[model samples]
Target: MSDQSSDAVPAQWSAPTAPGGDPIEKASGENFPVALRLLPPRIREDLRALYRYARHVDDLGDEWAGDRLSALDRIEADVRGLYEERREPTDPVVAALASTIARRRLPADPLLRLIEANRWDQQVTRYETFDDLLAYCRLSANPVGELVLHIFGRATPERIALSDRVCTALQLLEHWQDVAEDYRRGRVYLPQEDLRRFGVAEEDLARPTATSQLRALIAFETRRAEAWLDAGAALVAGLSGRARLAVSGYIAGGRAAAAALRRSDYDPLSRVPKPTSRQIASAWIRSVIRGWG
Candidate 1:
């Protein structure tokens, strides 16, 4: 996915979850399950704790209209508190993450990277090149996979590589789906070069429907994502038991989102594409029958 990870781990993760209430609702509001039923109860809290941090950071970055950088600075300070063994954290997200950090002995770097991604969001509204976008992913999406590997104790060199591929692919897919929404929010995730190459001006995205060039561009990006996703096939194939199934859901969800885009002729402006229940069930069933990476 990127050059950030030097020593990868084994690909053996499979799920995310949370207990009933505010955190759980926010966690479930995510596209993929943050705390899924397939994972163990012990894994659920830690996974949601991580998601709680990410979700809050994302809100401050993308949704808040105020001084996001200043708010994020506070978040960074609390992240340090988690590692410093502070008796208590005022922020509930950091408070929840404390035990998980101590229990797993997780590095603070991955969590900080996520925060850094949001910090970049405050300064960057558009990416000029594909490489530049990938650089953002290195800070934004890839850290979640890295954190997950660390949680599973499988942050080996090989697994990190595979996780990087999967996380980046998913991040790209999210950008594709949010073309209309991101534009309205004063952000655009599509590379500027690609937009120029395809004759897709920013105005084209502001329209009620995708222009033909925009559709073609979306289709091309979707195919590109699928190819990138294939790099993680070995990851799905290598794991076993519940962990394997959990990882399979991630790929399945991405493929389903791609399918929705295809079904609409890649016209994301018409509607955002999401995975349906049947499609998600099929993904799990197929993995059960066919075997996971």
Candidate 2:
């Protein structure tokens, strides 16, 4: 862990001048506040700036439902320019992100990986196995955890491993929650291998309610996510003070979400279960105490 802010370019990038340049509008409410509010003021600002940039990349992947490839190319170009600190082209998210990149020394690999995942979404709709879905999670999920590690000054090999577990678990939980919506988009995050193993057909996922096989598959995935949460719980112990609390919040959120899914009997088709505020509060408190202990 090194704080290399002083070794980089000055953090003086300008804001975009265009009207209505906010990027938070591009993300669902759930994606925007992963660690933004719980952080100190300056760190929260930096995290929001990074999140806005990531959200912009995601929007380019998703919003242009008809011409995703072209949109992704443009977004990629903008991201490259931001990384290079070329100010000639001005975009709101890029402007904010350029400063964040210079100040935080955040690498370009994670950002590019996220864009690539979105590109994959544009063309690849079916995952043949759990490994394939995990590959998708590498692109779609792992970067956020890497960025969080960067923010905490804790980008160790061990911490990154824990972060990956947490991120992948969260991504899987989200897929479980958005089963119907993903199906509506002509995509399926459920691996074909598990589907077959549990005797669930792709067509069954489209139905309004889960068949017994579907319930079995969902339960299996829930168990896997729980395992990830447990494996990644060490990330909280590895940190201290506010950094510890932040990591705990992330772990607790995933656990609470999984608990909600369990409460629903892993019935992804009938309804998507989400953690209630009470559950979030309870999980947060428990995680904090656990970290302390």
lDDT of 1 by residue, 1-293 (tens): 13212222113211222335534344312346321566897877787788777887787777655566666776788788767766455556677788898887789998899899998888899999989998998889888877877777767789878988888888888889889998998999999999999999999999989999999999999998877777876786666655566677777766776777798899999888766657756765775577652
What candidate 2 gets wrong by more than 4 Å, as runs, is: 1-36, 87-89
lDDT values, one for every candidate: 0.75, 0.73
Candidate 1 residue 272 C-alpha distance from true site, Å:
0.7
Q: Tens-digit lDDT track for model 2 on 36-116?
A: 346687776676677676776676676643455665665577778766766433445666677677778888888888889
Each candidate's root-mean-square deviation in Å?
8.3, 7.6
Please count the clashing residue pairs in each candidate, in the order shown.
20, 0
